[model samples]
Target: MNQELISHDGPGHRWLAERQVAGVKLGLERVKNLLKRMGDPQDTPAVAIVAGTNGKGSTSAMLAALCDEAGLQVGHFTSPHLVETRERYRVNGRCISAEQLDAALVHVRDCAGSDLAVTPFEVMAAAAYWLFRDLDLAVMEVGLGGRLDATNVTDPIVAVITQIARDHTRVLGDTLAAIAQEKVAVARQGRPVVMAHPTVTLAALRRIGLTCPVRKVGKDVQVQDVRIGGAGLGTQAVLRGRALSEPLQIELSLPGRHQLNNAAAAVLAYQEICAAWPKAWPDAVEVVWRLAEVPWPARLEVIETSPMMIVDGAHNTAGMRALAETMAERGKRWQVVLSVRDNRDPEPLIRELSAVSEGFWLPRMQADRMWDPHKLAEVIDLCAPHADVAVGSAQGCFEEARRQAHRSCGVVVTGSLYGIGEWLGRGEIVSPRLRRWLDGQAPQDQ
Candidate 1:
């Protein structure tokens, strides 16, 4: 580790960024060893591990908010931050300070030493665990497939799997069963597992077999009366299960019908935690109210109303399908600005977007792994031959989409979160702190 790099916030961030070349080293051995060297800071009594192809971030955010409302000092560790790397490490809904992050990175660098190589995400996961050591509770969102994800190093009190689908097929597997098997690995023996997915995924899990007691949404845990209201009205859901004394109605500020299922899974996981440590949490009503207030960004988020601009981090086929469904229900044929990572399959996403979009804008995300704009446009042309397509820089693409959209038509920014982040940094979306931080860094054309 370079002493200079470990001494400042910018240098520390660059140090982590440099590790991307190492790529994703899936497996817990390095993380586990690093934690052990640091005296096992991840050994906590209150921890929840959430794993899935989609909805994990939102679910984890909901769980963290609910736990915070219950008066516990909650530590939330998520990934692929929208604005800043510090966004991945949060306590009670507030991002960790740059100074704190720098300090934690110094410690993490020391723990890994000069020889033990770990990926950027593994380092961040260790740093978060170390930083959250003093918190009352922690909610960890798996960065990749659950089985060998670095976040799996911790012994979670409860495990959650939300809406499994065909994603990260290169790493997890090609089939749904193989993907389900990897996700279900987060379920520990003798602990409760909460899952919200289709019957096919459940069948896949059954075939793979699980040692932990699993609770399925709409089966063991019931969710009914799911109503997704108009834009900004939020969603309402009725949840019931062995964990609850009676049926509970939850109103989530987050939009989408799929969010209701995520809420059910979060409620079930919280209830399991409450059952194990009854005195640690508040009444169910209070916790339910807090769940409704979770502000999970970039999920069907309507940032601008006039010629509406909605940004969502829906990178996979399942998420694109959900986005398409939501847009269809709203009765708006969107002009979409789409970008995706090189690892993901763009054909299915393009097909889904074409179903609900009037035209498509293909943008090159300002990231190392972004898919080529021309290649993506070629796929878009093949998938939806009739739809109009434009290719350019991320900002230019979004600007062109917004310019072309009619008064009644909205502009939807979908695909990779990095693309959305790049678009957000382009002055259309204003986040003061993020903007200030971004200005200090080297400029990207996007």
Candidate 2:
């Protein structure tokens, strides 16, 4: 879709090189078609498919980390990177190197023709499977609605359903139960399809239990316990009459209360693996500790500088509420850099975010569906009238914001993962000296 990306040998360049003519409806035809052409690479590995309204990235990161701790070569493939596209493909706790991704891209692109109507996610699913064919474990995060999501191509050893909510109802369905059912379609055979859904959502999942094993978190493998703060939690995996006690406490560098479920889902999924492959399990304490130390961008990442540089992918009201809670407790005085795509509830979020920010700037973030800067600025003006505001292309506005940033002020770039990914990956603004010499010396915010 980009000039540099056309036939370019770069990490995840295959995603860019492949045709984006993918139909957006909820169906598995395109992925099935793509995989058929690729010789069914998705069936080659020990697969764990993760889907949810949110936390998929965090859960996938934890899963990969756990597999890595267990002395296995693991591959983690998540969508919407905070920095590089390569962040989507990690092998053994490491991002897939640019060279390796580039080579794989060349192979996938050479085989795919312009006539194919496959989506970019379909090609990526194929690439990750093709790349991880030799690995011991693989964690794949669904890109969209789960029923026909590209990652569903594989037969999951454990299908992880993180807490489901009302987001993406237009494509998946309107009701929470409907969305849960759509997302749950990735569950395979006798493998435990786990979820952290609330009671009502769990009820909907239970309806599908006759077809697959539904392992609800609180009911099946409870969080049992969690410590308040970034130190993560202490969890117990209770399945049937058996319980696995904690060998170590989980410590999360990421903030937000929601991360607790992500940590729980990862531990339980790991326990599921232990049940299947008892010999592959790691020390319980080590497993807990490993789960505690996962690094994902944008959830609660703070860039240390006077006035901090904070970035998050809070595209919905649920996410905005989480951001509000964290910032109220963590820091003060911030400028907000934000934008959103179509189908997102932008107006309500603008109202929520404006209450906390000192000023706001809206810009284009290289997303085809991203809201126009003029329209975004107009919405912010109505919602956050007390704060200073700027509108232009994201690059120009960010340049202006950086020029204004001092030791006493900070900036947060958010509203979508696409914006954060492009900004961080473009390699134009890595404040190395800021991290080295200016860490916490100035006001910071995210």
Candidate 3:
């Protein structure tokens, strides 16, 4: 079949899209059940499982990059591609080859025949496991809450939790502590855990410390030296006693200081992994280059020249805070293509964003779950008062913002990753991985 014929209309997309996954399977029984039927490929993989409220993609990207640099034939699994489904699965710093994906899916379908009436993620997890088992590495990002997430089926050498914050209240829980517990439960016994400054659940933190032998990022793996120039940036991780620093002065093409922190976390993860497997770890310079080379979209990504249009997936409070901080640091003013979750508290976020960006046209986001563009506008008015709030879908608001937005000023499409993908997809200028993933093309031998 021509590549053009494969689409949302095709059997492939429909099969996964139509069937929903259980957000909380509660146990690995179903995954184990599926694997037992297929052949347990994930039981003892050299894995780096990263769980967090924000920066999971960035952290995963960096982890995979560093691991690959360390001379490992890496396999990575992420979620909700900005462009294509294939972006969700990667091996050796590239999207999984079409041949690889096809073989894995064929086997998974055969074993899952009728018994694995599980969610789409469960099916993908199975497929990823099959593909990863053939590779030298297995770095997986948890799809949602950690405890019952499909990726949890893998036993990791390094279990990493990026940071803690609440986004999905309905499925996870109401309180921060409850949500943290759900995520921390993903940490298995004996693996060395690493994470950024966590402020969610003290109980969860204590539990992880006792049960999983954890390491707080800055405490265990700190950044000793950082140089941020243009085109690339590099930092040194104080790995145990050894100073793992690669001094490279450059700015990341991905944009934003938040990425720097994400980079820092990845460095820690890389250091920990290197210490765990010295024979596999490469030199520090190569790892730094690979980290800079990673492709993470919708984080202050500039796509236009005239009125530089940027998009980000700042969907939660922590994400919003990072976005605000990045904007403040840039000092380059911008108008926003804004939409926020209906469930999220708008006042605090509005107050933070007010210091940097403004809404372009509408009052808020669409009438989707936890989305209220109108409510967002009202909050902007009440909290920031000065920042203008946009009130339309990605396309509508973007067009309006383009017309009114000054050439000197820039456009930022943010507040939700959904909105970012929507606008960027429509515009056809999102990051290459997302675009290729959506298109389902195999990245040529690279």
If both were scored by TM-score, which would come out higher, candidate 1 or candidate 2? 1
Two-way lDDT contest, 2 vs 3, winner:
2
Off by over 4 Å in 1: 1-11, 198-210, 241-243, 278-280, 393-396, 430-446
Error of 2 at 156 (Å): 1.5
Which tens-of-lDDT digit does each residue in 1-446 have in candidate 2? 12223333554474555455454545678667766777777777789889988788888888778777778888889876554445567776556666777777656665665566666667667788889988878899998878778788776788888877778777878888888887777776577867777554556555666356666666545553444432121222222213346333556656566776677777778877777764757645566656445666566666544546666778877678767655554444567788787768688788777666777877666657778877877787788888788887657877777766563246767787666656655653453322221122211121
- In the range 1-446, model 3's lDDT, one tens digit per residue, is 01121223434454555445443354567777888887788864688888888887788888787777777888889876654556678877667655556566657767777756766678778878888886777989999988888888766788777777777888888877877888777676776777665555436867556465555655544554444333122223323323346443333445555666666677767777888884856656555656545666665555564665666777777888877766554444567767665566767766667777654454233335545666666677888776666565555666778775674256666776655554454563455545544444423322
What digit string (tens of lDDT, one per residue) describes model 1 on residues 295-387? 666787777766677778898889989888878766657798887888787998988888778788887655667789889889988998877
| Top candidate by TM-score | 1
User: Using TM-score as the measure, what is the rank order of every candidate, best first?
Assistant: 1, 3, 2
Superposing every Cα of model 3 onto the true structure, what RMSD results? 4.4
RMSD of each: 5.0, 5.8, 4.4
TM-score of each: 0.90, 0.82, 0.83
Give stretches of model 2 more than 4 Å off: 1-18, 23-26, 82-84, 109-116, 209-213, 219-242, 278-280, 331-333, 364-368, 392-410, 426-446
Model-by-model lDDT, in order?
Answer: 0.77, 0.67, 0.65
Among all windows of 10 consecutive residues in model 3, the one with the lowest summed lDDT is 1-10
Steric collisions counted per model: 0, 8, 25
